[model samples]
Target: MLVAYAWLTLVGFVVQLVPNAGPGALPRTLAWTVLGLGLVQCLLCTGVLHRAIDSYLGTRTVTDARLALPAVLMASMTALTVVLVAIRAVEVGLEVGLGLHGALAPFAVTFGVAVPRRTAALALSGYLAATTAALAAAGLPGADLLAALVVVGLGGLLSVFTGRSSAWYIAVIRELEEARGVQARLAVAEERLRFSRDLHDVMGRNLSAIALKSELAAQLVRRGSETEASVGQMTEVQRIAREAQSEVRAVVRGYRDVDLPTELAGARGILRAAGVDCRTDNGGSQLPAPVQAALGWVVREGATNVLRHADATWCTVWVGTDPAGRSALLVMENDGTRGQAPGGSAGSGLAGLRERLDGVGGTLRVARDGESGTFRLTAEVPLAAGNDATADEAVTDPAGTAGTHGSGTDGKDSAE
Candidate 1:
C-alpha cells in the first residue's frame, strides 16, 4: 500500500504539472524536482510508521529508543513536510499545493511510537509551533496558514486513531490464543490426576490389609505362640497378593497383549475358591497377540466381577476361532451380579473392556437379564486386524509370571 501510494503521488504530480506548465505556472525543472521529492516523502512516511509500529507489536526486533530521539526525529519530519508544501505553493497555486498536502498528510502521522507521555506532548506542541513559524516565513497569508494547519493536524490525528486501533485488536487476539493453549495444558494435567486416583482405587484397600496382617504375623512369631495363627496370617497375605496382582493386570493391559491360556487358568483358580465354579476354554489354538489380549482382559474382568458378586454361583468363558478362521470370538457369561446392581451400571468395567476391544478392530456386546440375574459380555476381534504385531513384547499383566494370580490354593469364606 505504501509503494502504491507513492506511485499515486508521482502520478498526481505528473497530471497537475501537465496542464499547469507554462508562463506564470509550474516550471518544468522545479515540477520534476517536487515530483521526485513527493514520492520519496510518501515512501519515507510509510517506513517511519513501521519504526513505531513494529517496535510496539514486537513484529521485529528493535533496540529501545531514548524517546527524545524518536520525538525529535518524528516532529522534525512533520515540520519539514509542512514547510516544503508552503514553499511549493509559491510556484503552484495555494489550492493545488494544499491538495498535494492532502496526499502527503499520511506521512506525518505516527502511531504507537512508545515514547514518554511528556516527550510525546512536547513533540506534538513543537511540531505545531515549527509548522506555523515555517509557513509564515514562507510568506503564507493568515487564512492560508490556518487552512494548512487544520488540514495537516486533522489528517495526522485521523491516521493515528486508525493505526492504534488495529494494533490494540491484534494484541488482544494474541493474548486470547495464548490463554487457550494454557487451558488445554491444564485439562491434560487434570486427566492425569484422575488416572492416578483410579490407580489408588485399585490398590489402596488391599495394601492397607496387607500392612495390618504382616504386623500381626510378626508379633505372633516373636511370642512363639499360636503358630497356626501366624501361618494363617501369611496365607491371607498370599491370597491378597494374588488379588492385587490380578487387579493390576485388569488396570493396565491395554498397552500390549496377555497369554490367553495363562489368563484362563488363573481366572478358573480364583473363581473356584470363591465357590463360583468358573470354567474357561481357549479352543486349543495360539491366537494373535491383539486377539488374545482382548480375550484375556475379558477373563480377568469377568473373574474379578464374579469373585466380587454376592451370589455369583457360576461363570463360563470361551475363546475360539470362527469357521472361516478369519476372526476370533470370545464370550463370558455369569449367573447373578447385575440384578442387585440396578441399571446394570456396575457394568462400567465392561465399558472399558469394550474400548479395549475397539482398539484391536473388534466389537463387544453386553446383556443383563434382571429377571434371571445373569450378566454376559461378548467380544470378537479379527485375526488379520492386528497386522502381525512386532514380536510379542512382554506384558506386565498378572500373567507376567505363568500363574501369579493362581499361586494361592487356599479358599476363604469371602472373596477379597
Candidate 2:
C-alpha cells in the first residue's frame, strides 16, 4: 500500500512535466534527486515497519510495546531524508499542492508501522505543527497550507487504524501458539498423574500387608516361638512381592501402549481447540493391537504438524480397513500449506513416521495438491495374509462428511 501510494504521487509529479509546465516544474537533475530520495526513504520505511513489529511482538512485559533501536534509527534517517526532499521541492519552486503530499508519504508509514501508540499522537501533533511552520516559511498561502495539513493528517490516522488492526491479529496468533504449548504440557502432565495413580494402587495395599507380616515375624522371633510361622510368613511375603511385580509390569505396559480410539478422540479434540475444524472416524473397535499403535502415532504426529505449520481451517483423520480388506489404512489430511510442496515436509518428522510404520509392515505415502493446497498422508499396514475380516465402513466417505466432529473451542461437538 505504501509503495503504491508513493508511486501514485510520483505519477502526479510526472504529469506536471508536460510542455509549458507551471511553477511546479523542476530541472532534470532536481527531479532525479527527488526520485533517488524517494526510493531510499521507502526502503527505510519498510525496514522500520518490520523492526517495529518484531519489537512489539517480542515484548513479554509491556502491553503498549517499545520500539527497537534499529527501527528508531531508521525512522530518524528517513525523517532527515524527508526534510531534504521537502527543501529541494521548495528550492525548485514546486507548488505546495503538487509536491507537499509526496513529501508526506513516508510519515504515514513511519507513524503507522514503526511508532508505538504511546507516543504516536504527540509525535503526530508535533509533526503537523512543524510542517505548518515549514510551509509558511516557504511562502505558501494560508489556505493551501491548511489543506495540505488536513490531507496529510487524515492519511496518517487512517494508516494508524489499519496498521494497528493488523498488528492486533498478529498478537492474537502469538497468544494462540503459547496456548497450544501449554495444552501439550498439560496433556503430558495428566498422563503422568494417571500412571502414578496406577502404580500407587498396585503397590499400596500389598506393601502394607508385607510390612505387617514382617513385624509379626520379628515379634515371634523375639518371643522365642517356633520358626515355622515366621518362615511361612516370609514365604507369603515373597508371593505377594511376585504378584505386585507382575501387576506393576502390566501397568507399565499399558502406559506405554496407545489405545486407537482414545488417540482418535484426542487428535480431534486437540485440533478443534486449536481452531481447525476436525473430523475423525475410528472405523472399527477391534483393530490388531500393533496396527492400532502404529496408526495412533500417525494421528499424533499429523495433528502436531498441522498445529505448528499449517494455515489450515479444516482437518480429517480416518482409520479403518482398505477396500480390499487386506490392509488396515489410516489417513490424515488437511487443506493448508506453509509454502511446502507435497512430500516437502518429510524432514519435519515424516521420516520418523515412516520408520515406525515400516516396523509394522506398513508404508506411508504423502500426496499433495499444489493448486488446491491439500496435504494428504496415507499409512497402510498390511493385514496378516489371508485376513480380510476388517471392515471398510470408516473409509466409505473419504472426506469424513458423515463422521464425528471435533468442534471449535467455543462450540459443542457432535457426531454426524
Candidate 3:
C-alpha cells in the first residue's frame, strides 16, 4: 500500500514535467526535485513506519532519534509539495486547483499510517491550516479556499482512520502471540508433571521391594539362621535395580524420539507465534522411522537457530527426495542471518545433528548467503535399502559411537 501511494505520487510529479508548449525548465526542475525528495522520504519512512507499528504492538522499543530524521524529511517534502502546487495554481488560475489540495494528501496519509493518533491528528491539522493560509496569501479566492479545506480535511481523516486500523490489527496479532506463548509454557509444565509422576511410579515399587528385602536379610543375618535366604534377598534387590534402570532408559528414549510430523507442526506454530512466517512442505511421507526422527531433529534445531541466532521474518522447511531419488533431502531456509558466520565454527546443536545424521548414513550442510542475508540448513540421507541396513548396523554396534566429519561451511557431516 505504501509503495502504491509512492508510485502514484511519482506519477503526479511526472505529469508536472510536461509543459503547455515545449517544456518549462523551472516546472520540470521542481518536479524532478520533488520526485527525488519523495523517493528519499519513502525510503526513510519505511523504517519509521515499521518501528512505529512494532512499538505499538509492544514487540519493539524505538528511540526518538530513529524516527526524528524521517519525520523531518516528510514535513519538508510536504511543505515543498504544497508550495509548488500553490505556485502552479496561481499561474494557471483554478485549473490546477485540485493539485493544491491534493499536495498534502500523501504526507497526511503517511502520517496517519505511521504516527500515533493524537500526534498524527495534531500535525495534520497544523499542516492543513498552514497550507490553507499559504494558498490564501497567494491570492486564492474564498471559494477556492473552502474547496481546498474540504479536500485536505477528508485526506486527514483517511490518514487517521488508516493509522488507527493498523494499530488495532497489530494489537490483535500481539495478543494471539502472547496467548500462544502461554499455551506452550503450560504444555511444558504439564509434560514435566507427567514425567515426574512416571518416574515416581517406576521407582516407587522397586524401592519398596528393595527396602522389604533388605529388612528380611538383616533379620536373617542377625538371627544367623541361614545365608541362603539373605543371598536370595540380595539377588532380588539387584534384579529390582536392573528393572528400574531399564524403565528409566525406556522413558528417556520415549522423550528423545520426537515424531517428525509433530515437530514440523510445532516448528510452524512456534515460529508463527514469534511473528515469523513459517511454511513447511512434506514432499512425501513414506520415510522410515529412523529417517523421520533424524529430520525431526533437524527441524527442531533449525527453528531454534532461527529464534535465537537470526532476526528472520520468514522461514521455510522442506522435505523431499533428492533429484536422483537416491536420497531424501530436508532443507530449512530463513532470511536475516545477521551476526552469523556462513563458514565459521559449528554450534553444539549443529555438531550433534552432524553426529546423528552420520550415525544414520546421512550428511548435514549449512550455508549462509551474505548477499541475501539468509541461512540454509540442508540434510540428506540415502533412501536405498542398504542405507537403512547400515543405519541399523550402526545402532546395534556396541562400540560404534556416532562421530562427526567437517563439512567446510559451519556444519558437520554425520557419515561414518
Candidate 4:
C-alpha cells in the first residue's frame, strides 16, 4: 500500500510538470491539493481492497458485503483520480488525452510482475491495450498514437519475460520433486534388504538343524530301535524351533551380531557369486571381539558398495591384528572398471563407513587405483589381547586355521 502511494506521488509530480497550464495561484493550489488527496485515497483503497481480496480468496464462504465494499471503494478512488487528472490536463490548455502507456503502467506492475498468471494476466494486458487504443484515438495528436503503440509493445515484452520466469519455476519444481521421489525409492529398497537379511538369519540355522534331526529320526525308524532316538530327535527339533523363534525376535529388534569371520565368508560368497574372484587373507586367528565387530561392519559396507557401485571381476579381502599394540586392519579391494560414477556423486557410502568406524575409535579409507581401476576400502580398529579370545580359539582349532600369520603378513596386507 505504501508502495502504491509512492507510485501515485511520482505520477502526480509528473502530471504537474505538463506544459501550458495558465499561470494562476488558485488553479495551481487546487491542482496540487487534489493530486495529494487522490494519492492518499489511492493508498487507502489499495489497502482495503488488498485485505478484502485476501479474505475472499482465503475463505470458502463469501458474503455480498465482502465483495461490494472493496469494489465500491476502488471504483470511487479510481474515478476521482481520473476526473482530477482529466480536469488538470484541460486546465493546462492542451487537449486532454490519456496516454495508454502511462495508464497501463500500474496494471503491468501488478498483473505482469506481481500476480504473474498467464491466461488471465494476458487477458488483462489485452484489455489495457484496447482501452489505450480507444483513448489514443480521442483528442490529442500523433503523440497519443505513438504512446499507445509503445504500451502494446511493452506489454508483449512483459508477457514473454513473465512466461519465461514461470517456465523456469516449473523446471526447478520438477527437479526437486524428482529428487524426493528417488530418495523415497532408496528408503524402501533399504527396508526390503533389512527384512531379507533378518529373515535369512532367523531361518537358516534352525532349518538346517531340523533337517539333520529329521534324517537321524528316519534312520532310527528304519532300524526299528526308534523309540528313544525318535523322541530325542523330536526334542531337538522343538529346541531348534524355539531357538529360531528367539532369533527371529532378536533380528526384528536389530540385535543380531556379526562375527568377523562370518562376515568375511559372506563377502567371499557374494563376490564369487557376482563372478568376481575372491582372495582373502587374515593373519592367523580371530580378531578381538570389539575390533572384529567394527571390522564386520566395514566388511558389510564394503561388500554393499562392491555390489552396488563397483562392477568388479577380481576382489581381495584382508584382515590382520596389530602387533605393536591393540589395533586391527580390514581391507577389501576390487578390480572394478570405472568408466564414470553414477550421478557424479563422490562416495557417500564410504563417508558413512568412515563415520561409523570413527564412532568406534577407528578410521576408514577409500582409494581408487586409476591404472588397475581397482577400488580399495580399509578400516583400522583398536583392540586388546584379552578381547581377541575367539580369534585365539580359532587359531588353536586346526579346522579353522587359514590365512597367513603375524606382523610379517601385515606388510603384505598393507600392499593391498
Candidate 5:
C-alpha cells in the first residue's frame, strides 16, 4: 500500500509538470523538490516502519526520534504538495484546484506505515492545519479551503486506522513468541522434576532399610547380644548400599528400563501438550519383560528425538510382535524430519539404546523418507531363544570372554 501511494505521488508530480497543468516556474521547482523529498521519505519510511514492526514484535527497540523522522517528512511532503496546489488555486481562481492532491496521497498512505496511532493522528492534524493556513494565506475562498480540509481530513483518519491495525497484528505475533518461550521453559522444569522423582524412587526404600539395620546392629552391640546378628546386619547394610549405588548409576545413565505402557502414555501426553498429534498401538504386552524393556527404551528415545530435533505436527507409535511372531517390534514415525539424516551416526542417547538393544539380540533401524518429509525408527528384538541366547552366550562363549578381556574389544564394539 505504501509503495502504491509512493508511485501515485510520483505520477502526480509528473502530471503537474505537463503544459496543461499551468505550472509556473516556482510551482514546477517546488514540485520537483517535493518529488525528491518523497523519494527519500519513502526509503527512510520503509526502514523506520520495519523497525517499528520489530519493536512491536519484541525483537528490537526503537526510540521516538527514529519514528518521528519519517512521519515528519511525510507531513512535510503533504503540506508542500498542498502549498503548490494552493498557489495554482490562487492564480486561476480555484479552477486549477487540487491538481496535486494525488501527490498528497502517498504521504497519507505512509503516515500509517511510519507512525503509531496517536503519532500518526497528531502528524496528520498538524499537516491539515498547515494546509488550511496556507490556503487562506493564498486567498483561497472559504468554501474551497473547507473542501480541501475535508478531503485531507478523511485521508488522515484512514491512516490512523491503518497504523492501529498494524500495531494490533504485530502485538499478536509478539504474544505467540512469548508463549512459545514459556512452554520451552516449562518443559525443562518438568524434566528436572522427573529426574528428581526417579532418584527418590530408586534410593528411598533402600536407604530406609539400611538405616533400620544399622539401628538394629547398634542395639545388639549395646545389649551384648550375639555377634552373629550384628555381623549379619552389617553385611545386609553393605549389600543394600551396593544395590542402591547400582540403581543410582542406572538412573543417572538413563539405563533403567521404563515400563512400555507407562512410557507410551507419557509420550502421547507430552506430544499433545506440545501441540503435536500423537497416536499409539499397545499390542506387544504379551512380549517377554526383557523384550518389552528394550522396546520401551526405543520408544523413549524416539519420542525424545521427535521433541528435540523435529518440528513435527504428528507422531505415531506402534508396538507389536513382528508378522512372524519371532520378534518384538517397535516403530515410531513422525512428520517434519527437517531434512536431517535419519538415525545419523548414533548420538549418546541412541548409542546407549543401541547397546541395550544389542544385549538382547535386537537391532535398531532408522529410515528417512525425504519425499514425504517423515522419519521412522524401528527397534526389533527376537522374541524366542535369540533374546536369551544373546545374554547366555555373552556369559558362556570363550570368544565373548576373549573379546571382553583382550584389548577392550567388547567395550569398543558396544560403543560403536
Candidate 6:
C-alpha cells in the first residue's frame, strides 16, 4: 500500500509539472493544491487496499459470486482514476497517451485467462504486433516502429530457443538413466559367469578323480589283487568321492574353490563314474587363474548335471585352452534323455551352471542334438592379467577345502 501510494504521488508530481494537469480551481491555488489532492487519493486508497490483498490470496475462487463484486468495485475505482487522468491530460494539453505499459496489458490479461501454450504464444505475438501498429499510427518517432519490431522478434526467438534447449536437456537426462540400467544388467551377467567358472573348477576334477579311482579299485578286485592294495585304492577313491560331494554342495550354495585343473579332472571322473564317457582335452597352461576358474565352474556344473539328470550310457566332458593362450574353454555333452526325461525337468544344475559362467566374462550355451540324443554344454573364458602359474600357486592354499569342494561340512553323510 505504501509503495502504491509513493508511485501514485510520483506520477502526480510529474503531471503537475505540465500546466493545468490537475482538477478544479482549488488545485490551481498554491495553498490548497498538493495537500488536498494527496488527502483525497489516500482516502480513496483505503477501500482498494484490502481488496488487493484478498485478490493476491485468491480468497474468492474464480467462480465464486464474491469475485464479481470485488472485481466490479475495483473496475469502478480504476475507471474513475482513468477519467480523472484523462480530464487532467486534456486540461493540461499534455501528450499523456498510452505507452509501453499499456501495450503489455493485453498479454498479461491473456495469461490470466489461462490459455493453452500454443494459443498463448500466438496471442502474445498478435498482441505485440497490434500494439506496434497502434503506436505507429499514433505517430511514434521516426523508424522507432522498426526498432520495436526488432525487439519483439528477438523476444519471440529467445522464448522458442530456450524452450527447445530445456526439452533437449530433459531428453539427455533420460538417456543417461537408461544407460545406467544397461550397465547394471551387464554387471549381473558377469557375476553369474564368474560363479559358473568357480563351480566347474571345484567339482569337475574332484568327481573325475573319484570315478577313476573307484573304477581302478573295482578292476583290482576283479583281478584278485592283494587286499592291502585294493583297500588303499578304495580309501583314496572314497576320499576323492567325499571331496566331489562337498564341491557339488558348495557350488549349489553359490560358493566354490578357484582350482581349475583339479576341478576339470574331478568333473571327468565324476561323469565317467556316472557312466558317461568323460574327457578333458586341455589344462589351460597359459590361461589366467580367473579364466581357469571360470572354465572349471562350467565343467563342474555340466558334469554334475549329467550325473544327476542324463539318464544315458555316456557323457563326454572336454576342456580346451585357447591356442593363443589367452582363454580357456570347457565343453560337456551327454547322450541322455533320448525322449524327454519324465515331465522334461532339466533340473537346477544347468540353470546354476549358466549363472556361474556369466559371472566372469564367460558364456554357457546348452543345446540338444535332436537326432543324436546328445545334450551339450559349452563355455568360454577370457584371460585376465596376472594369470600364471605363480598366481595359481598363490591362490592354491586349499583354504576352501570345505566350502569350495563341498565336503558337506556336516557331521555325517546320509547313506546313498
Which has the better TM-score: candidate 2, or candidate 5? 2
- lDDT by residue (1-416, candidate 3, tens digit) is 64455446445633453342124566566655655665676676565666666776667766767656655665565455455555552244232333433344445555565556788778877877876777677666777667766765675576557656766786886688678678869999999998889889888998999899999999999999899999999878776765665566556567668688999999999899788999999874787677788889999998987776779999999998888888889999999576666665668999999998897789999888977888889999777643565575476332333212121112321111
* Model 5 Cα lDDT, one tens digit per residue, 142-186: 787676677557645654566556667668756765786787799
Candidate 1 backbone clash number:
0
After superposing candidate 2, which stretches have Cα over 4 Å from the reference? Answer: 1-31, 58-102, 112-115, 129-150, 214-227, 257-262, 272-282, 285-294, 309-314, 335-338, 341-363, 367-374, 382-416
The lDDT of model 4 is 0.56
Candidate 4 per-residue lDDT, tens place, 297-348, comes to 7887788777676778888898886567567877788877466542344478
Ranked candidates, highest TM-score first? 2, 3, 5, 1, 4, 6
Better of 2 and 4 by lDDT: 2
Tell me each candidate's RMSD, in Å, in order.
20.0, 11.2, 9.0, 15.2, 8.4, 24.1
Query: Mind giving the per-residue lDDT tens digits that candidate 2 earns over 1-416?
Result: 54465456544643342221223535344444555555565565565565556555765322233334323433343343334345443333244334444544554555555556867777667766776676666565567667766865665565565556666777898898888788779989999999999999999999999999989888878888879998898878776765665566557657767777888898898888878999998884677776787788888888888877787889998888988878889889899774666556466588998987886678999888888888888999887621321233233222343222222111211111
TM-score of 2: 0.66
Best by TM-score: 2
Deviation from native of the Cα of residue 348 in model 5, angstroms: 7.2
Cα lDDT tens digits, model 1, 198-291, are: 6688789989999999999999999999999999999898878778767765555432346778889988886675567887877836776667
Global local distance difference test of model 3: 0.68
Q: Candidate 3, after superposition: displacement of residue 270 in Å? A: 4.9
List residue ranges in candidate 4 displaced over 4 A: 1-122, 152-182, 197-359, 362-416
Error of 6 at 207 (Å): 2.6
User: 41, model 6: CA deviation in Å?
Assistant: 36
**Ten contiguous residues with the weakest lDDT in model 2:** 407-416
Per-candidate Cα lDDT values, in order, are 0.62, 0.64, 0.68, 0.56, 0.69, 0.52
- In candidate 4, position 35 carries an lDDT of 45
Model 6 lDDT per residue over 1-416, tens place: 23243234324432443354365653344213332443344443333434433333344223334233433332332233234333442222122222222222222221323223465467557745764555455454435555545544454444333333443454565666566567658878997888789877887888788778788888889999677888998888767766676555546544445577788778777566545677666746656666776777676666666655667777666676658866567777778858763346556776776676666666777777767777877787666433543364354323444434444454423321
Candidate 5 lands at a TM-score of: 0.56
